[model samples]
Target: MIANEIKKRVLIALLIILPILMAPVDLFLAPNYWVKSLVKCILFIGLPLILNNHYQWVSIKSMLTVTKKQLSLIALVMIATYGTIIFGYQLLERWFDFSMITVQLESSMAITKNNFWFVFFYIPLVNALVEEWFFRGFGFLTLKKFFSRRWSYFLSAIIFSLYHVAIMAHWFSPLLFTLLVIGLIGVGLFFNYINEKTGTFLTSYMVHAGANFAINTIGLYLFGMI
Candidate 1:
């Protein structure tokens, strides 16, 4: 009973508090971008691996592989997600001005724009892999121990969405931030859904990386920094 209570408390903090704390730490405490990203990766990915393993909160598995059918579906979804983002951005550009939007993120994205190859390569690969492993694989599964499967999924989504608060609130207008909250929460839920449905972490990672690729590639180019 004592052990179970400890596990529940730990998982609750991870799922509820860690994500909220991430923004402030990155925004105020971290000394530089390098440290900020490293800190985030360690907290989001490393801490879970260490604690969850120690607690035996989940079973270890080969989360990197997908069957042929799953692979095909992932490919189709990747293409569709990338295409949709591109199309949607084009439509937005036709009507609204994004100069204000781009400027808000200029400092945050300057490094990305300068390191085009890094953004093109790392963001979609290693970064996505770690995030999926942390959130869907560890965090969501841990919550399943204390909650129903659907509740686990939703809570994971909430944590993921809240994790971006510092960025969204600081780098976006109120209206844009509100919209982003809704969108990213939906995305978080969707990724968890895909992970559960396909029974592999790679599928959800692909969808996430694909979406980032779509947004970042065009945005960097437009900023004239890439």
Candidate 2:
């Protein structure tokens, strides 16, 4: 029993620490976008598979399942998310220089007008899947087994938000950065709630995909592709 307890603690610690460590790779170590994506895939997707095989922390089949009710909820959430992001951008763009987002993307990731369509689709679909699997499937659901429900939700949401700070560190002003971090926390919590309802991450993934679609739409406008 004691050995099992120790093993659980160690696994939880690794879950928390690995992501914090990965932040630096996003901020500094990764030389390009593809490299970063590959590294993230290894860390988030590959590592979880290894861990799940050993610890049985989450049921892969359960995490992938989606109900008819969840499908309807997902559609509503996606539409609301899309509208909110688009409207928010329109309202905030006058005050904040969002064009720098495109500038940074081009300079850092080699993203450009030509390849943005590929990136647009990839980010909303693939990136969202990776993140939901990591943060909700592994991070929250797994942690909920060992920790109280509240701690599991809060810790997962916090780590999710902080992890993105490294990714977006240079993208905004200090005030905007602070606001975005708070917003990310809220979004993270809401994602947790969605997953908690469906016993799966697909609901949150759909909502995340919609939000990314809105952001990528804005990106298209910035690139003058629209």
Candidate 3:
């Protein structure tokens, strides 16, 4: 079962990694929006849920059946974190008027205009939810069962960081990439901590969704696209 889970993870990684690898080809050469969306949905999100050998830290029924207490706590943390993200982005933009991060996000602005529904809905909803489900849900939880808890967290953080590295590799400089990796690893650890603390993946998913929502929403505002 463990070996099968490992194999499943490897297969899932290829699903995700191939899209990241072919991003330029997809975006520049062919330019098929639906194809890219399908990859993100089926490969990244769908298969993870269907693959039986891997982790299911929070059962589907539990995810659906959140208690009143869980709902309140999730709302509280999400509100606080959402405020902090807007605050942090505002502060950071003041210092760095132009940034690699901004450049990366600007590229995504086309999606908001071209496919308003996908950007406004899918990005803040499905994309963010599945990422937490995949990285924190599957990666961190599965690793913890196999290794020391700290090692599990550390390996999970590394995997999370490395995944971003593939997506952002060609888009930034060495220095910028290093900083981005460091930042993502920190996010991975924090998300993992919240998952453990709340004893539910919903908190992490909510927070993750909030963060991505802020990024795209604020990016459009700053870029004068909205």
Candidate 4:
């Protein structure tokens, strides 16, 4: 119970801090970019240490179980998801006469200058693994303890969507926000389902990594950002 309470408190604190850390651009360059980075360091780095030390978070081995079929399935799912999104975009464009959807993320200073190695390696491998471990692993499980399964799923999806939007609120349009939120819900469910079925964070990590990698890569190339 105490652990549950601590988990809830941590999540609530994250909820409170993330928005302020990611306020809309105070101009073109966002005056609060440094503050946002500081908050991210605290949440993504510092909070994990505290949780692992104080709450006995799951072991690394337990978090990432490797299996042949699991990895292949993850790739398949990612491909299928990307195809579906492309199809949806086409349909929406045809029906609604919309051109394309685009959002600009604040890339690292080093990455903007064609640092493909840093963007590809750091993003897909390290960042994806760490994010899925924290959000879908610890955050999802902790939320499930206090809420119904449906609510837990919904809440996690909201958090995922909100995190993305909060980071780029300056560029967020209503149409893109809707699409992004819907996409995030699907991604959240996919991760949660993988975690539940495989009973390992590794499986979810693979799926999460695949989805993020596909979308980011495709989006960048298609939108001429790469």
Maximum-TM-score candidate: 2
Task: Residues 1-226, candidate 3: write the lDDT tens digits.
Answer: 8865666566456434644554554345433444555665665557657763354433555433456887788878877877887888778666454445445444632343445436756766877776676677656655555457897678778777776654566555676568779998998899888777665567788888878777766656755567
lDDT of 1 by residue, 132-215 (tens): 777787777557767788888888887787777775566655776787898888998889888878776788889988988888
| Candidate 3 segments exceeding 4 Å error | 1-34, 53-65, 97-118, 170-177
Residues 1-226 of candidate 4 have per-residue lDDT tens digits of 8877776677656544643454443223444334444555566657765766675544545556767887787778767765775566556554452323332433412224244435645666666676676667665655665667887677776776666765444444577667767877787787887776776666777666665666556556545666
In order, what lDDT does every prediction score?
0.75, 0.87, 0.64, 0.60
lDDT per residue as tens, model 2, 83-149: 9999999999999987788888877777889889999999989999999989988888877877889
Off by over 4 Å in 2: none
RMSD of 1: 2.3
lDDT of 2: 0.87
TM-score of 4: 0.70
Off by over 4 Å in 1: 101-106, 109-112
**Which candidate's lDDT is highest?**
2
Against the true structure, what is each candidate's TM-score?
Answer: 0.88, 0.95, 0.74, 0.70
Ranking by lDDT: 2, 1, 3, 4
lDDT of 1 at 153: 81
Error in Å for residue 83 of model 3: 1.5
Clashing residue pairs in candidate 1 (N, C-alpha, C atoms within 3 angstroms): none
